[model samples]
Target: MWPEVKIVHGKPTHSQSQGSVERAHRDIEEMLGAWMDENKTKDWPAGIKFIQFKKNRALHSGIGRSPYEAMFGCPARVGQASAGIPHDLMNHLATEEDIENLLKEMEGESNDLEDPNSHGEREDEENTVPETVDAVRTESNEDVVCGQCYTVLPLGEEVNNDGKCFNCERQGNIVNERKRSRESLEKQATKMLKLSKKKFSEVQVGTTVRVPIPDVDRARGSPRNVLAVVGSVEDGLYKLCMCS
Candidate 1:
């Protein structure tokens, strides 16, 4: 009899299948944490872009090159210092007028960086999404409007639980619009997890579990522990059946 060959697919929760992605996530978290500690600030979103830039330019042991260099034929181009224009060539080729123009451009950039109004404008642009949503909500007509873009809900079109119209809900614009910075959310989540921490044995299929009686049931002199057996597990959720 010939041996049978079968291919077994990995489960979605299988860590082995996502080792590299998990490692990358760990590296990002460590770098972001260090950055936050150094800055004495919890604003991770501000530092994440800089971390991403650094990560791309960093040499990778596996790839034998920086990710930026691997993607492009050359190393990542950064500030004016590494602009790749040869100093000798510039001195020989650039006219006095060209040099003056370059100095004027650099001065303009420096002035823009120093300008408080310019910085405020950049911050305003970053924070405008919530303001836009609020403005849209206030200006919307009495007719059913999408929670996201404030577009009128057409007849026969469904609105989600949050009152977002079909198109807006499908595109997840409402969720995206309401999203806080990842670092802020992650910090909040960590605090919540710490506050809610409890010790419990690992649950599995066929494991016996005890559920607490509701307040109303307890008032009626019901037992605190209601015994149940886990029937199945899916996506960290356990299906349980009360013992007869």
Candidate 2:
């Protein structure tokens, strides 16, 4: 069993106590915002993995190294999975340019009657056509769908019990719309925080400021701000003292 860690609570008035955590949250929010824009989907669970990967790899300004490097005491091997492929095997792999070059070579060789061996190679490739066709047909036959309706049919054993396709069990649901709503909510929250930050006026010691009051906890028509003078400013935050 691991040793129990003590949690130190910071004063609600001073957010500077949890500066690192707040900063990290801001960074993650920015990343999530970008991902939402790029993917245009509410699949945040999928995108979180990519965010974590980037965070671990990215260099920390304070640490002078990435989180992965700091923890492992070594630089992370990026794309090592793909890089592990043998150089000889990689060279043998045909890319688009290689395929294009191959077509050009075949065309040139086709005209050159001098190369009788090239024709034999082309004939050998053509011989595999029947096998490919048979494989496609076999796969298509195995993928049996509901004959009455075009929906995917159940497996052999399941089909006997149900006697109908899965979609036949009617249910109305808007899964895609729900996901879009969630995505919109997350984006709106991020945008609101950004806009609020921008609208915030700079405060210094002796400067009076107005802050919003929660409507749920108090009366809806209650005054938004109680006149409060800034006592001190540290780390770009105002320490406000209420004026009598």
TM-score of each: 0.32, 0.33
Whole-model Cα lDDT per candidate?
0.69, 0.64
The CA lDDT at 138 in model 2 is 84
The residue ranges of model 1 lying beyond 4 angstroms of the native Cα positions read 1-13, 78-244
TM-score (C-alpha, index-matched) for candidate 1: 0.32
Clashes of each: 0, 0
Mark the regions of model 2 whose C-alpha exceeds 4 Å error after superposition. 1-12, 80-83, 86-244
Taking every candidate in turn, the Cα RMSD to the unseen true structure, in Å, is 23.1, 20.4
Candidate 2 residue lDDT tens string, 1-244? 5469765453344355688788899999899879978999888888998898888879765545566655545456664223444344446646766545655775776586567767887687779977986786687676555544656653441332444454442211133333444566677668877897899856657887776664443455668657788899888778888855
Can you give the lDDT of residue 57 in candidate 1? 93
Per-residue CA lDDT of model 1 for 1-244, tens digit only, reads 5469765443334246597798899999999999999999988999989999999999765545566655544567775436444456465534667656676776887798899879877787769867876676678634677877988775346678897776765455433422423334566667656675544445878988888864543644557778999999887677999847
Where is model 2 poorest over a 10-residue stretch in terms of lDDT?
169-178
State how far residue 89 of model 1 sits from its true place (Å): 8.7
